[model samples]
Target: MGGAMKIVLIDSNARAVSSEDREVSVGSLTRLLGSKPAVTARLPNGDRLLTAKEPCVDNGFTIGRSRVVVGAGVVVGKRDAVGAYTPPKTNVDTLTKLVRWVAPDNMPRESEDGRTMVTAILVDPETRDIRQVSLRSDAGSLDGAVGGRCRFMMRVTTADAVFVKVGIGPRAAWRKDGLVFPGRSLIVGCSRYGTLVDVATDIASLRASVEFKSPDAPDWLPPSR
Candidate 1:
């Protein structure tokens, strides 16, 4: 069922007298997110919701938690609606960290050859600094060409996020060359704090573009247009 409680609102200052707290609604959630709110919140459940009428999706990533679109903003939790003062489940703030913790076991394996695997995750945000990534294990042979078909035997080389259509299951395995994410990659792995798209799924996919960060980049993703 849909959640209740409208957090977003429209504004007006038509009269001379002041008033008490009133509810407001907005037409679009996208505009609200674009406004770049100062505060973002998460409820008791696993969703990463906001109070000031903002949508959640950004860049090529979605907040791992489920979201309920309220009046203008979104509420992240299990139930559709809850009390206004919903507390968080953990002390670990930040949406990315929340998602990484939300899914403790989302590491993915391929379906084709079933031999390749994803081992690490890293991020390079447009404005944020590139935090050093700690590899949990050795990801063997992430890219190559077999039978003239380019793919990762198992490797991730670039920092650009490879977008995918389906969410991966933890410790899940797929056949080799089976991951077909849109932009030059096909691997996804989960970290202690979140999931990551293996942008360097193969050699050819990375070689397909030249307009990005490095000459050796399998794909190119400038911070922003």
Candidate 2:
């Protein structure tokens, strides 16, 4: 029906190992390579699938002059025949993008406990004051944090108008923990606001004045007779 799909196998040093141009599908490619292929990178025309016998290795191939040490032998070909392709917009990837958007000058760091933290420099649009705050979240990896937290922080520091509400309920009245709201709440709340700027700024003036109180504080407790 169409031109036969072609695949090129390259070694760790970007040397061409072999080429196969025939009736190629993901199943056939897997049988030929003897392992499930993992897409290590995406090119303009196709994707690079890791086909090395030892997928985990120090040495790797180069895409132009840049060395990509993610895997050993890699199969380069069109992704049409590959199995369900996962877009690069995974939670971790999104988190990374948002982190960069909110904190262009700082890089995200990973803690030993596997949380990602980024320092966002917020600028007040009114008085032009600047404040730096650490945003942390867990996305199950060291590469980035969850998108939810980053998105919340993004709105808090960027939105021209942001509204925040705090409420408390009896532990027995709530299905989940009543002491604190789930982190997802922030994500849902911020979803209503669209991104307006990249750099973090306290345009709302609330960031610099907000205070956190312990749950044990008398005012936080419900009034009793």
Pairs in steric clash, model 2: 123-201
lDDT of each: 0.30, 0.34
Against the true structure, candidate 2 reaches a TM-score of 0.27
List the lowest-lDDT window of 10 residues for candidate 2: 188-197
Model 1, position 88, has a per-residue lDDT of 30
lDDT of 1 at 102: 19
lDDT tens readout by residue for model 1, 84-155: 323333333343332322121333434365332343322222221122222222222222201112233333
Q: Which model scores highest in lDDT?
A: 2
Off by over 4 Å in 2: 1-4, 22-28, 31-34, 46-58, 65-67, 70-225
- Model 1 off-target regions past 4 Å? 1-24, 28-31, 34-60, 65-73, 76-96, 99-225
Cα lDDT of model 2 by residue, 90-209, tens digit:
232322222211121222344576444434333222222334444442222111222222222223322232211222442111011223321211221111112122233332443333
